[model samples]
Target chain A: MEYAYYPGCTLKQSAFPLDRQSRKVLRALGHGLTEIRDWNCCGATSASKLDDFLEVAMPARNIGIAESAGFEEMLIPCSACYSKTVVAKTRMNRDPRLKQEINSELAHQVRGEIRVSSILEPLFDAARSRELGQRVSRQLSGVVAACYYGCMLTRFPLDVDLRDDAENPGFMEAVLEAAGGTSLDWQEKTFCCGASATVYDRETALDLMGRIFSDALARGANCLVTLCPVCQMNMDAYQEAYCSRLGRSRRLPVLFITELVGLALGLGYKELYLDRHFVDPAPLLREMERQQETEAAS
Target chain B: MQEQTAFQVSGDAARELSAEIAGRSEQPIASCYQCRRCAAGCPVGEATGYLTPDRLIRMVLLGDRKMALNNDLVWRCLSCYTCGTRCPNGIHTSRVTETLKQMAREERLEPLHPKTDSFHRSFVKTSLFWGRMNEVGLMAAYQARVLWSCLKRRDFREMRSEISSQTRFGLSLFRLGRLHPGWTVSRGRRELGRLAAKSGRHSR
Candidate 1:
């Protein structure tokens, strides 16, 4: 299967691991991704707040670019980007005036038509059931993970509908099942990590993150897994900051869904971008390794 | 501004907003039992003081237009629908809040919160003009309102790196070269005028 992929801005920079692991997982699933030509930002947090028309046009430009690439569906991994693009498409499709205005403004830069979807949607669609069956190597027995959808993935459910149940979502449980891991029943999975506020308001962001982490840990989750890079970054990076600010020793490993999928696939640990994490996954890795060896000897 | 003390909404407007809400939501607002779940789950309310979903609903149910318009909670909502999903009674608190905001803005009873109107206006202007947000512009505007030092020192490097990377990915603020050529101040005025005209013609 071939797909048009829009990796977004974050995947290339600080959250490079998500991009690397996502591609690897898709490749292993026999899908090839052709990057959309001259794709632009989805105008999520800042853009949406700035100019409504620009928000639609910005993602529309990239969508048009992807459509021109001869791809019907565009796979986006970042939740923020996914929300923005899907929202833009929905708005443009609904508003003729908006469609004309944005198209007129971006007549030069844009090409083709794009139908945007989150990376999770296609993964859930194409490979989920089969990927579950292929899990013979290692089963993450007894490991409990909190599957975090964060806010972006579920926020605009009407537009994107990527989330299974907007009210009480647990689709991640099925994905986690493929890795032989049991996802915990946690309330904080759908909460916001204060995505863009990490820069402007560290205190509020930390308070929100701390609440999420504490709730998940209290429920006995070994780690938190999410699809959005911002969520992963905030959950991991802010753990240290929160620990320092509050005077405590705190460590909770944050894993992108692809990283967990990579682990289940028995791919090399470093290849999954495990090294880039601020909080080490070594303890969890060693424990999993030890468990695997014990099972082998037994 | 003496009229700004509060635009006392009548039973007619509250009933109208509630009826409009019911038409869209298919859920009754009067069923709300004052369970603070809506306020409890709100992400924006965690920061903005006293902007509770329950209180807004209370105002609507009681037809206390002045109370509803005066509260900052009416417009502070991010419309994430956390409250609606969490509400056992199926009350659409966000919709009620939105109608309140529209009514409040119309009656010139905008809450005297710091920079709230400016923030909303700037956000809408950015979206309407460029069809996306200009993050740099938003950051500059927000920072100007909150104070420069709140941004912290040495954060520019990080912000710059982020900006450059987004530009490479085609999410640049500079890309919004101009608003749609037809989107002039007069066009907006015309649209608003048309809306007011339509509403006026229909009201009779």
Candidate 2:
């Protein structure tokens, strides 16, 4: 499959690994990837608060670009971008008048036909087809992951074209399992990760992050895996502060699902940028390797 | 039935406020039936100083504009949409919060969470400025506004805290190569400027 990919703001810098490996892995799987020409920010949660038209128009602009570029599939790795764009398209499709008005202001016409999807869509498809498993060079035998959905992707199932159970999503689990990782069933799979609040409202962000981490830890999960940059960044970067605040020494690592898939697909730590995360996953991977060695000895 | 009243909506101004929010957010605020399912599922229910999803909806319904707009709930909403997914009435509290925040800003009311407001404003402004966000630009702009607000209030303690925390966290990010020194703008400036101006006019 060919895609016009939008890297958004974070993916270009802070979350570049997700962008880089998404390109490499998707290409390796025989998928064509093209970065959208001059795609702008989707306005995210901030846009909605700025102006209603902006919330729709900003993302609508990207959709229009993709549509005009004649791309059938537009893959956005960030959940915030994916959610806002999908919601904008859904609104435009539902309201013809709004569509026409937005179109008049749009530099490009939004035909509302280009299919937008999060990174999960392709990964899930490959996993389902066993194509991902076939290419898994290293089996993630001892890795246990908690697949996190982080609100935007699943919260508006009806409004957005997100195909999953918002309350109980398992696509990530299936995808990870194909890479030989074990996924645990946890209650906070669909919890909110306090997106931009991570910057402005540390109290709320930390509290939300703590709850998800506690739940995942309680379930005997080794790490929390998610596609949302906000989720990954906060949970991984803030775990130390949370641990210090709570006087708990145990740290929970948060990994981007793509990074784990990269590891399974024989990508190196530096290559996937795993070493940059605050809560290092190298120890966890080493522990997993030890467990596998013990089992082999037995 | 058991008591004098559990909740009630009366007064024209209050009802009008509810209607305005409903219309602006396009959410079915009228259908929110205090089911508390939203409260049951809200990730921030415990932390939001008694402003649960259902209670916020109740406040909106009752037209408590001050509380509705400047409350901890509005400032801290994650826009996670969990409440909307569970609302039998399909009322998205996230949308309601967004609308209330916008209204609060229009009223020129000082936001209870000045930092959040600063972050939001800087994020939007920088995104509009570059058509894509330059992380350095966003933080610099947001830091300036927040510091100015602190200075205006003469809250030196907060100013110190903000500076220390930002520097510590930001340095870590810079080391990890997340905080880039470079600025990258997109090629969609024409559309962004046109849309921003058009939206502002339409909003008015």
Candidate 3:
């Protein structure tokens, strides 16, 4: 099946791996994804919180562009973008005035039907993913993964049904299992990493990150896997502040969901978007290499 | 960081809040074993001194009402559900905390700590009245609430202390320039009010 794709700004830039790996996995799984040619930014977090109309129209513009590109169901990998697009879709469907207002602002002009979905749900769609899970060449049995679903992914009323459970999501578990990893059934899975606040409030941000990381460590998780780019950046880049404030350096590797899936599919680490990560995955990289050497010797 | 306060909670309201507000499962509140996992996982609990999901449950089991509502712990929860995600018994601790906040609001009980609730409320109230949230109108309405509440208690001094120098500095940042003209808060409220009323009609 062909799915229209939106790689909102981050996935094209800092989180390019999410876009790259998503395409790789979708192609390998025998699904076709056609990206809208001239998609604009979904206004990320700032636009939605700043104004209601801009939030709806900004995302609707992409939906309009995607519709114009000849597709119905679109996949968004970034959690914020997923939230923005889905939330806007809900507004357009529920409120006619809002729809009329937002549609008027579009350039390419789309007055058609569109459905937006996060990469998580489509990955969890059993009919589409069972074969993909069976194709996993490597069994990450020892890899203990913690799934983090930061805010906006599930909180906003309009974007509520993106996961199995909005409050206590299990999309990570489904994706992790497909990638052959042992996931911790821990409570910190749905916690927020203080996403937008990290820009202006370091103290609060570090404190929030510290709490989540420490909890994951306590649960014996080896690495934290997140679907959102900002969540990955916060967990990966903020280790220094976490060390300074908490008085202990704790480095927990954060991997994008696509990167993890690619690894399970026996794809090279380089292609999995490993290099773009802020917290060097050198330790995990070395560990993966060591495992490979052992298998080769055997 | 502020020193942790000694707050006491009654087991009944804690359990009741869990049942009525937080929408905890109808099973049993006593099932929780104080694993401390809930508190450890909570996002808001990590930032604020007052909140802890584990302790809130303990308060309910022990029948600690004053501790639950008066300590300002209820407001600290971001309702993100990190605790419930891992809860073995599936108790929704976050929902329970929210119920406590709603109860506190209805009772006109003083909030345990200073918060942006007044600001958010003014935003909501203005939207209810005008179909949009005017930033200038919201700020002014919030100030009026602060002034009115202070006058009711005849304790403007206490109110003055609540608005710390740091908070004032933060407030100044919003005033640097016109940020928002208006918002759909008013429109949202109208729809929400209709839904609420319709739900009420159905239940009755």
Q: Please name the candidate that would achieve the greatest DockQ relative to the true structure.
A: 2
Q: Return the interface RMSD of the candidates, in order shown, one decimal each.
A: 10.3, 2.1, 11.6
Candidate 2 segments exceeding 4 Å error: A291-298, B1-10, B201-204
- Model 2: lDDT of residue B148: 95
DockQ scores of the candidates: 0.09, 0.62, 0.06
For residues B1-204, write the lDDT of model 3, one tens digit per residue: 335445455556555654653332232456788787777766666466545777777665655665665554465555455576567776667546645654565566767643334543554445335433344565567667766777788987856864553255334333422133333222233333343233221111
Q: Would you estimate the TM-scores of all the predictions?
A: 0.70, 0.95, 0.61
lDDT of 2 by residue, A133-227 (tens): 99998888888888988887787623665577778998899999999899998888988877788788888788887888888888999888999
For all candidates in order, the CA lDDT equals 0.64, 0.84, 0.64
Per-model B-chain TM-score: 0.54, 0.89, 0.63
Q: On DockQ, who's better, 2 or 3?
A: 2
Task: Give the Å shift of residue B169 in candidate 2.
Answer: 1.1
* Model 2 lDDT tens row, B37-112: 8888887777774678788888878876667778778877777888888888888888889889899888889788
